[model samples]
Target: MLAKARQSLRAACDQLNIHPDVYEELKWPRETLAATLLIRMDDGSRRAFKAWRCRYNDRRGPTKGGIRFHPNVSLDEIETLAFWMTFKCAVANLPFGGGKGGVCVNTKELSQTELERLSRAYIEAFAPFVGPDRDILAPDMYTNGIVIAWMADEYSSITGQASPSALTGKPLAFGGTVGRVDATARGGYHALRHLEKSLEIDPDNSKVAIQGFGNVGYHCAKLLHADGYTIVGISDSSGGIYDEKGFDPLAVMQHKHETGSVQGAKGHGKTRNITNAELLELDCDVLVPAALERQITLENCDRIKARVILELANGPVAPTADRKLTEEGHIIIPDILANSGGVTVSHLEWVQNRSGYYWDASEVADHLKKTMERETQAIWALHNEMSLSMREAAYIHGLRRIAESVEARGTQAYFDGA
Candidate 1:
């Protein structure tokens, strides 16, 4: 994953004719920390789990990313995620670099007490490296606001300091931004809104399909549906349900909440159960892969027929598929830009924590809309002016900022002096 991420960045740099030396400093992470987390099991036995934190860069600002608790977590994956976070933050114009941390454990198997202990232990182990001005951790896969709150509390108690800014995505009572929960989806909506004029598709007339039913996917479906888009299909990990005429996203969400899946929800349109692969190929105006990385690969790029492919999931469209889709004239909204709302809101949360001021939901939403629109226009303008792919244009736009910062700081002089 790290190799692929570096390849994508390098490809973009090459298209821009960026000097290889400029990229030499950007290719590898500044630091990668691995630790063993010792937690007492519910059965009174202790187990050690491997955990990792990767700080990709700090040229722009403090590192910002999430801590994911999953069985498949590894140092390489965390580093790749941190690298993506750097670009994502840069694309969003946030004052943050990239960092990510994760523990290789399935939280579902642990009891509530055990989960808390594990969360604290993970923070305790990494406390020396993370802080408000260092690396700030948020919530990611299998981790939520509760986990973030726990981690933040642990950090504060351990350090005996008031450091709410050390983490984002905590519960609102603990300083989380009001719009953080749906920030990722909301950001995607803003990107799609900005692209509507270029795509020449009316929201009311467009049929939308989302290939994941998690927080990001469901919230995206809701926001788009409220905006008058016809949600034609929705899916989860198990499978997806499709309706040709369009489905009520709110109803589907309620059903999914009750039934734990959207597979068997009764609807007016054709209720056919389809695999995620089949759902991706459905004839829709916009297809959103909000699930996981590599969902859209070279093998399945030919099957996609959507006019606009909005990636709400991180790395949902693989590099190989990205090339194919670009060749096929698909307006692929890259994840760095499409799914940056969460981090944008995280910035808001951090600001609020630092300033002791908070905004209402409408205020937050309006602020988010303006930021997303401005950034989208910037990226779109760059793409048109340079005749480059959106992904390449975004990378060029973001990398230039980071590269300029690195140069302005005389970073190379320090090494030369050494």
Candidate 2:
């Protein structure tokens, strides 16, 4: 993942003809901290979980990113994610750098008490390294609003102050942004809506297949399905359900919630269960790979039949496959631009937390929609202006922002006076 990240950065820098120093500056992380947290289990045993946090860059502002709790968490993955977040925030024109954190543990394997203890323990270990003005953490992957509340409470207790700005994705009762829960999917909805005409999408006839029925995936699918698109296929970690006549995303979500997976979502229609890989290869108008990274690589790139790819998952399309898909005229709304609604609202939550003021859900949704639409249009315009791939265009746009910031602060070469 880190290698692919560097490759994209290199391409963007080369395309922009940026200063060598700028590329050199971005080649490494600003800071990386790793630690092990030991907590006693209900079985009267102690288990140690490895955790990591990486600040990719702070040229723009304080770092902001998500803290995921997945079994595959690692320092390299966190660093790559942080680097992507830096670009993601810049692409959305947010005042934040990139930071990410994670602990290598499966949340499903833990009881409620065990999970709470682990989440708080993670905050305790990294409390000294994170803050609103330094690095703010949000939910990602297996992490959610409840988990974020725990972390925020831990940070507050540790500092002896109520600082909800130090964390995001909190429950609404604990100072979270009003519209943050569905921000990611809502943003993608606006982006795709902004591109529907250009992408030649027929809302009445468009067949959508979403891989991953998690938070981001479910919300995105739900929104798109409500917007008249045919949600023909959808999946979770276990598997997926597909129907030629299209399935209601909400019903599928309800089934998943009740049955622990979306594998057997019946009563609405006759749907066949499919694997994640099969879902990826399913012929559809728009394919949303919102599950994990490197999902649409070269091996499966040739099998993709979607006219458009909206990456609700970070780094879902490998760099090589991205080139191929673009060459084949498949419009890909990159993750930096597609899934940035979460961080954009995270910034808003930080602002509200700092001001000790809150806005209604409608206000948050309006702001998010405006930002996502504007940024999506901007990327489309850049794509046409430069005759570049969407991913390349996004990278160049963000790289320019970072390059300008880096030069402005480091050399003061472009400024007239100090």
Q: How much lDDT does each candidate structure score?
A: 0.89, 0.90
Error of 1 at 10 (Å): 1.7
Off by over 4 Å in 2: 267-269, 412-418
Error of 1 at 310 (Å): 0.6
Candidate 2 lDDT over residue span 142-170, tens digit each: 88888998899999999999998999889
Model 1, 283-389: lDDT tens digits are: 99999999878888888889899989998988888888888889889988888899888999999899999999998999889988988888889999998998888
lDDT, candidate 1, at 31: 98
TM-score of 1: 0.96
Q: Any residue pairs clashing in model 2, and if so which?
A: none
Model 2 quality (TM-score): 0.97
